[model samples]
Target: MSVASEILTALRSEEHDPVRLLRSASNLLGDEIAVMSSFGAESALLLAFVAEAAPDMRVLFLETGKHFPETLAYRSELARFLGLTNVQDIKPYLAQVKDRDPTGELWAFDPDACCQLRKVEPLDAATLSFPVLVTGRKRGQASTRAALPVVEEKPDGQVRLNPLASWSADEITDEMKRRGLPPHPLVSKGYPSIGCAPCTRPVGENQDARSGRWAGLSKTECGIHTAS
Candidate 1:
């Protein structure tokens, strides 16, 4: 079996344990693995696991120029709190940004294109050398992800690991509470899902956690996760 398949097989038994999965992946992939984070709601849970298992693991955060000031601040605060030493902010190319979105209002007319420019391109470029990618996506977050797998192999042979794929919202909340993890400040304000400022909003108590993201539009993801 290939290394990816072996990794998957080994992780099957401990799929529910994020820290164990992270440690195993770190051991297997070493410098070829990196974690992609948004530093949004519930992000602390995954970062905590990274801190415990691989404190120096490369953590890539898409620093879209449109993120809320609160999110930028929270990213710094959470990194400090978890003692994550390798968190890097991935930003889009300045030439592309100026050529495509000079006014910074592309999100108003075409959010998908904006996301492609700011998130997808930057992440694709940043992760080109990494063979394994880790994310905190969960099945319970949205209907589109209801069947998310713990391990997925992209067409290009890159392995995407979702250690928290099977975790429920309650499980996440309980674990975070038990660990005293600090939440994204916007979560208490009803923004259970936080993204770029212009395309995100607060949802009702009964709404899906991700419903506030790209509200009124069909776009659910920021293209970084969906592309490739």
Candidate 2:
């Protein structure tokens, strides 16, 4: 079996406990595991676990220039609230952004390419040294992630860990409440899945949490998660 498969098998019993899963992964990978966080709605839950289990673990945030001001504020507030010491803001290369999206309107004409330049490439560069990448993705957020597993090896041989893969929306809310964690400021404004301001919108009551992201387009993911 691959190392990721072996670790997944060993961690099966703790899959339901995100804190335990994170702690175990930290123990197993030492300094090779890092987390990717969007600091959007429900991000605090995973970040809280990170604070408790691995306070100093590198928490990478894709600081795309187009994010809502509220999201930027909340990112600072939550990191302070959670006592996270290593939250790194990963920004896209300025030269590439200038060359590919000179007008900064790429999100209007080609969101996929926008995300590739702003999020995917930056994240890929930020995580190059980490063999194990942890994320806050959950199955309840979108149909595309419905079958997400707790651990899987990517095509590049990197182990991607979705510690909260099976958590429901209610479970996330309850746990965050139980821990007294604050919600992202945009959540009250109807953004269940917040992203860059230009591409995100407010979804209706019955819509998927992630339906707000890239609203009219068929694009569900922002390329970072889908890319190897």
Predictions in order: lDDT: 0.90, 0.89
Can you tell me which runs of candidate 1 are displaced by over 4 Å?
1-4
Model 2 bad stretches (over 4 Å): 1-8
* lDDT tens readout by residue for model 1, 39-69: 9998999999999999999999999999999
- Model 1, 42: alpha-carbon shift in Å? 0.7
Give the per-residue lDDT digits (tens) of candidate 2, residues 75-113.
999999999999999999999999999999999998889
Position 155, candidate 2: lDDT: 81
Candidate 1, residue 17: the lDDT equals 77
Top model number, lDDT:
1
- Return the top candidate by TM-score: 1
Over the full model, what C-alpha lDDT does candidate 1 score relative to the true structure?
0.90
Q: Lowest-lDDT window of 10 residues in candidate 1?
A: 1-10
User: Which residue pairs clash within candidate 2?
Assistant: none
How many clashes in candidate 1? 0
